[model samples]
Target chain A: MSQGRERVYINDVAPRDGLQIEKQWVATADKVRLIDGLMATGLARVEATSFVSPRAIPNLADAAEVVQGIRRVSGVGIVVLVPNVKGCERALASGVDEINLVMSASESHSRANLRMSPEQSLAQFAEIVDLAKGSGVFVNGSLSTAFGCPFDGEVPQSRVLGFIERLLELGVEGVTLADTTGMANPAQVARLCEAVMTRWSQVPFTLHVHNTRGMGLANCLAAWQSGVTQFDAALGGLGGCPFAPGATGNVCTEDLVHMFEQMGVDTGVDLAALIELSTTLPELVGHDVPGQVAKAGPADRRYPCPAGL
Target chain B: MSQGRERVYINDVAPRDGLQIEKQWVATADKVRLIDGLMATGLARVEATSFVSPRAIPNLADAAEVVQGIRRVSGVGIVVLVPNVKGCERALASGVDEINLVMSASESHSRANLRMSPEQSLAQFAEIVDLAKGSGVFVNGSLSTAFGCPFDGEVPQSRVLGFIERLLELGVEGVTLADTTGMANPAQVARLCEAVMTRWSQVPFTLHVHNTRGMGLANCLAAWQSGVTQFDAALGGLGGCPFAPGATGNVCTEDLVHMFEQMGVDTGVDLAALIELSTTLPELVGHDVPGQVAKAGPADRRYPCPAGL
Candidate 1:
């Protein structure tokens, strides 16, 4: 039997990654209410919004208003995705607790998504880190398509490791390895997570996986068995990749918490509260979200015997 | 890293378990075609149909015709669920390779689903075994609610082991531990699977799981890591429990095969062929199925860069 971690930390990225691609415009008030509802559920961190170009992602245009409107809890971290030094400046001015810088591990994905090469993205990240150095805001770097790219089939583990080294050297405090297109399998997740946990023992690494192919929970189980203590999930499984159309988004937060809690691991989040919050997502997004626990209830839920049986 | 089993065996139970719960009646020819298509995908076994009372499960009322109409492939076992000596006689006369006997481990589930106590079910199983003893037919006993039950919250592991011992003593050749309500978590699956593997080293054990709470693939991963090589899956994630309304049915066969194959474990089945067959399920069932690989494609599927990127 594998000696899995005893507890896990989860960052709900629904407000940012989950909503950025949505066609309907979520009002600024509704976005704040959603983030605050998530925070009330005791999430470790909430990726409130992304301070990217509004022209590129019009849905999350009110990133600053969202960050400023949320009821900041003392222990909960409010994170926002920042694209460059300009976005970083906006996020810091909004009094965010953490600034999440973005980059891609694959060349084609880097060009397609960010409109910059990997090297160019790294140079921008270095400038953002320098800008946020003395501001006391935690710096997290999210490496998109770290597992595989839609255009470029596989991103080598050695290349991912090299980028991690560069990100840390640029004064980034934490790193998130994102399976942007839901291409990661359990064995591969275990191998890569083990490699990072072994090499960067002191650095905190988070796994961000999509459920496009239905291996989301299995990949999370593999990563947990390999000693990963932090994860990135979206409420109602809300995020999707523009490149992989018809694909589901990140692993659902309530479902992931249900799995871990059922396995006797502590996630420090109220599952019932999370599920209750997830029910309002359809109205918020104008469509159904992919979360299952909310629809199916938790595993511990019992049913009455069939009538007359 | 877990030294998981090198190869896995899959039994597609869509024809029996998946179709039995459907609200619409599936035509016998379509059922035969589905089973034949699944077998042609190089599956190790296919549960063609069940010989239960038509009043209880009308969808599978054409059991004998389904068993006789399917093109028998060499090296692929054709199995059927037999509820009593009558079902066993019909299945044996139809020239099936295996007869599956089922009973619930939980008392409430046993009474509610099968309308019999555990002891009564065991007695009936012994009678069927005696009837099929000299027919050269393999006896496979399936213990439903082996993990947890909807009416009775948790089924103890020790109680499950006792039932397995009884099934073996009754001349059962193999056993399937079923999570009837999708109540199983990965830790529970790992513990039960490891116990069974350690105690009954020679007996072939199959895991039957549901995706009700979204832990289906995770539970499969745990069971696989605990030395389980045989799995029971339904094509297109068909099937649901009558007790747990709104719950999804058996784990998707195509999704499971995709996961195992992507992990570099040999499943001995053609995944692309399986997915191709999954596309026809919506038209056959008159509804969209829940399998994701069929919707999103496999992990290795590549896409061209977005226009102008």
Candidate 2:
């Protein structure tokens, strides 16, 4: 419990991870409103949108408009998801503060999802990393299926280490270990984070997990214990893997914040505001969302004494 | 991580704690069916019913019949919730293997919920404890609101230790520290369990947490790290404090079991069978249940490769 007082960093991935698979097309104005709502709650970093081809993810086809429509705050950094050099070029012109590059740890997943071998994806990333170096934009490399690959199953830790080494050498400022389909357990999370943190002590490491198996936050806690604090969560748990049929969504950002704040960990989040915004998600998506704090409220929240009692 | 491989004991409190507040009167036979289903999943302990007045908890009014009707499996124990000497007398006659006595650490919660002051409740517990010493039944004293009280708020660790001393002195074989309204945080849970285990090393400590703030499993993980292993959870996250207005439900037993099993901690539970039973709960209660794993599947469950991919 010594880490109870430590401040944990959070990066909301709702606009990118959460909304990627939404069938209902949200208006660009609505996406901008949601992003502004999240920024108003004191989140330092918000993954606002992704610059993928409209044919790849039509729901986020308005990514450029979203970045253009959302008000920019002084301290909040906006993140844009980019897959290749072309996406990076679009993101650089889109005025985002950071760009996140995606790759896969397993060749099967890389071929199925990204249509490239791991090495091919890394080679493409090298160009994107080099292209963005002098543009004043931070590049974050994310390794998908780092915990377990649905297509191949049981990704080797050595593959993750190799990817990390190459990503760092590519001049990426940070790396995200993405549990693309929520396949990680706490023990596995601890072992991987320990191995990575021991060797590359200076590189910023973040966890991108899903609640597919309901171990998302448990894995986050294990990562924190292993000395990795930065995390990526989605508001209302909006996103899931389209290829992975049963994958739920990324860990709910508000629920994660509620847990951290309750445990006396400083998250620099306004829980009341977050919960309030979480309630509006059901109407936004035309369905009820998966967040918990919106339904349960904070721990100290009190109800009025019953009439008779 | 050191405790990742340890086996944790689970007491499925669905019949007693779960159905106690259910609006639909789950037929007495349905209760028996549910209990039988749980027992077949290799769970060692099942809290069968409560022996309180039928008018007090009408849902469990068939407690005696449920105890008599459920199929008994070898190596499994049935526990009943008892509030006073009369409940204890009835539970003893019903032939439950264990009886859990309830009191609250906060005087306000005790009076509001049980209509007795803390001291008066303990005095009555003394008689109930004396009556069943040689009756071949294990006595468990549960301090409700020991973690935090909705009425009084922030129950002190000193008060909990004082109550633990009294319960142990009264010959209770075990004590369960209950987060009655889900107010306990992870750090608070770790600190309190550490203090209690330090003073009463021989007493069996179990955790009974609610998901009021969605910290149920997190608190259990904290308590587990502090050397407490036994826990009480409800299937499908059923049951909350009927008196605490905003309290949600207990930790989802299958979700907790899934998390533990994924981390290589054994609960001897057949997860596939438990999951199968969880899918039937929505029809049993006529509404959606709160459990996560049922909808999300297990961590290792893989979907078939899509045709094009």
Candidate 3:
């Protein structure tokens, strides 16, 4: 657990999470180029691709090739998403450093998103943890829909806690509570974090929040107050919950890192380099990404405000 | 002194703070109509106009007439901005219940916005406070450019606290710390609020944060942690910072209130009513305002998502 507060650990997901939600199919080489560019920016971690079935996510069908073709930077850790045991095996073959296992908290959301119930997902998580442990690979579990579910309105706090306990028992190193539907308010976040912190004081928790209800950063602050430090954000605010309505963008990684570093909290990531990486994204992904900071630049960068208005 | 957590005080500013930066000159009757509509929605405080010189702010030249035309609703407190002693006298004559006095913390911003040095502006603040006290009118002082200034880059925390101490010495009842250039990062906000709260434990402070750097909501959460509750926001994200580059909107009042209420924080204002009031704004102001909650509807209010992206 590298808890040296001097730097922020940026997990750039421009290749995996950023491209997965787009309607257009980006070429495999373009994906590799984007990943290479992100790695050059000194981002500590990068999610390269998901080894899910091609029939489900056509955009990431070249997941294996993207991982194989990219010129890997020496110090950067390349992580990939896995759906099931087969997906985990595929990820191991790609020669990645880490594995991210995702499961939904709400039964309704789990069925809709991953096509599994809560019990089945928990069983899968245990198997994934066991597999990673045997192969000497690190495992990070994501409890999606921890905040609220689009299919099922409100997920009980106990359910989220229970899932965390189960994942901890499975020997997962870290956990991320995701706002899959962006239904989290600060108070709910505060109350839940306080409860979890009271019990599992040493558990490493990360926040993966969406800006759907416009409380992404606020929710992050609430989690921060409760002693959770790590945050998961997509560069350029790309990626959306295909099932979560109107929840169309992740908290922009550049924007989050900017806010953190400016506050004197070190995320160890370079914002200028991240902004530069953002510039080449539109050509790579086909359409412009939705990050406001990327398009408008930082607070100091000036632009021509419309005349007279 | 009303610390009853259930009763949240909402001070509507569509007429004064909201209209000052607007490029279009709204008619006096339309302003009155907008105020009337806002009042009908159970609002207690509505800022009617600024008593500045006609040439200085052309949009609010007919300040007195606008205030006088509105049939002041029973129990609704009409407030107006008073730039100096003369403005205070004029606002009192216009039959407003409260007077708002503002001065920028940064010297450059104070000169650009108020045409006075910080010392001169504080002198004006003292005179206005005295005039309001003599006339039995309530006075609320605002420290603009408290967070960060567009001209001077980051405004020091010491300068902001020093200004607050000066206002407290002047017997000002309430104070608002404004992000005039919208350069507030969450950490900066948290550190400043802690400083203010540690020094002045009893003084009530309101945050008038702008969304220029996209940290408006994050700054709000930081303040919430520091125990400062009141906030000033425009409905429809109406106003923009005259100095911060591309900073073209205030934090939407409905959005702020919604986030607060959802977190069980008791911001007594009605979100639905605020939304309805936002809809009537375009016709009254002769153009559309920039609030997203009004256009996108509330978090729970969902629309049918079209076919997959």
Candidate 4:
């Protein structure tokens, strides 16, 4: 019905987004191991680390080391999150494939999380884009809080589009619309994605959703129906910005992949490998993670039939 | 966009489906209180209890008393699950607004769960439908495992439609398609629901989905998009058939309602009241329930802003 089977690209952000907010420090070796496991799953893209200030996010203090340590899988594009020009330098120095720049769509969120206004953040992005233009490493601009903000009840769509306009003008290769606080509904996701894709039809627009209100996958379905093929998910449904405390984290990568593949949509990533990696998350993070697929198993997974039958 | 506001009916099955598999024996008073609370949430239909062999499901042994003890809310239809003539007669005596009859769509499932062949099950339904015809009680025929069965890997679409054909011929007033073992995907749900609705256009077709593999709401969305309106959900997602041991509970009523209502679809139920009722479930059941809204709060629920912001 949707033409032919669509291949959805999963951009795993577990190592970077997941562990960044964790109070328990994941050792650098473990970080590399998790990234390697994800790479072996045949994912086309994986966000391995964030080059943010060590003092700000101590959990990812060994970002550059973790990036350098991973055994790069052939054909897998490695990505790293960068907060500023220093992070950009660090990521470029690590030979990353993509440099993901972060900024908040809501001014209140920008002030609380990044301590900069949207305009100031975009001004900084211009310099980063110029630096990455000839570095062979593409820049992806992520607009956080694109849906709604905790401090600001509703973010105007015009405000989000204006920021996207500025990011495109800065020559960023792509954009990721993030539901930072999980304040999104299926209808809202469909409408916004359609509008954005209408203008940026060729540029890849990924949906970075959270499961905070448990609409992460639902929003993804809506977005996919609206022609979005790329998604940002963490390993165990882990990670939420500290500023947005109650946000559940990104949608689980394995869970998302399982649902898509079972629906006849191709996610390219190997679910068995991802699920095996998912089982090790609790031990790796020193606490249980919140993903249902790993515990419940995949959709087609059958249990022993009733004994008598 | 969806013709102004579309109203979707949510049938609360926490009492019948939710507590039926719960190990803890809830007091009759608590059952009545729960039904009453659900009534106050403006739900139009609620499945209060199931009258089955106590030997089979001891959890709902006090079905009759519990059904009669509930304080009826005006304009709300109270339904009960009935297995046989005896159960139907008891439900009639208790003055139930509707009688929900269930039989598995898969032959293997019917044999293991209902311990009868599809032919034998339909033959029994004839007498029950005849009894309900003149008694002014509506009979909702529920076909469990309509999508997939654990025992029989994939239940053919032909098999499900055959059951629907027999049920409709048996003089049933409505039909409900259930994903008993949670072995349904969005594509499968959309295809089956579309086929069934196309054939039985005007019937009050309902969807009863499980979150076993976390595809409950996603399947519901697919079904909804395919024009299936009525849905059966449990409060706090408190159910799983014992015979189908690992299968999760029905979709969470509040979660589904929240998603639908937020998408500009009217469910005619008060989410705040439903959420308040969800908070009391863990204490009522003596264990935690599987619902996100109660823990994470609603999408609009806001937290205190950071100091600077």
Candidate achieving the largest lDDT: 1
> Which should have the higher TM-score, number 3 or number 4?
4
- Among all windows of 10 consecutive residues in model 4 chain A, the one with the lowest summed lDDT is A240-249
Estimate, for each residue in B1-309, the C-alpha lDDT of model 4 and write its tens digit.
Answer: 354438889999999889887878999989999999999998879999998998998988899889878888898999999899889888998898999999988778889889998788888888888888788889999998898887677888998999898898889889999988777888899899999999989888999988876678878888888888889999988887544444347788888988898788999999999999998988888887777777677777766778855
RMSD of 3: 4.0
List each candidate's DockQ score.
0.76, 0.50, 0.29, 0.57
RMSD of candidate 2 to the truth, in angstroms, is 1.9
Scored by DockQ, the top model is: 1
What ranking of all candidate models by DockQ puts the best one first? 1, 4, 2, 3
lDDT of 2 at B198: 90
Q: Give candidate 2's error at residue B292 in angstroms.
A: 1.8
Task: Sort by TM-score, best first.
Answer: 1, 4, 2, 3
Q: For residues A1-309, could you state the per-residue lDDT of candidate 1 as single tens digits?
A: 447578899999999989998889999999999999999998999999999999989998888888889998989999999999899999989998999988999988999989999999999988999999899999999898898998999999999999999999999999999999999999999999999999999999999999998899999999998889899999999999776666689999999999999989999999999999999999999998888899888878888887787
Off by over 4 Å in 2: A241-248, A307-309, B241-248
- Model 3 in CAPRI terms: which quality? acceptable
Better of 1 and 4 by DockQ: 1
Instruction: Name the weakest run of 10 consecutive residues (lDDT summed) in model 3 chain A.
Output: A300-309
lDDT of 4 by residue, A124-204 (tens): 998898888889998899999999888887888888999999899899889999998888888899889999999889989
| TM-score against truth, every candidate | 0.99, 0.96, 0.89, 0.97
Model 1 per-residue lDDT at A55: 90
Q: What is the C-alpha lDDT of each candidate?
A: 0.92, 0.86, 0.77, 0.86
Error of 2 at B43 (Å): 0.9
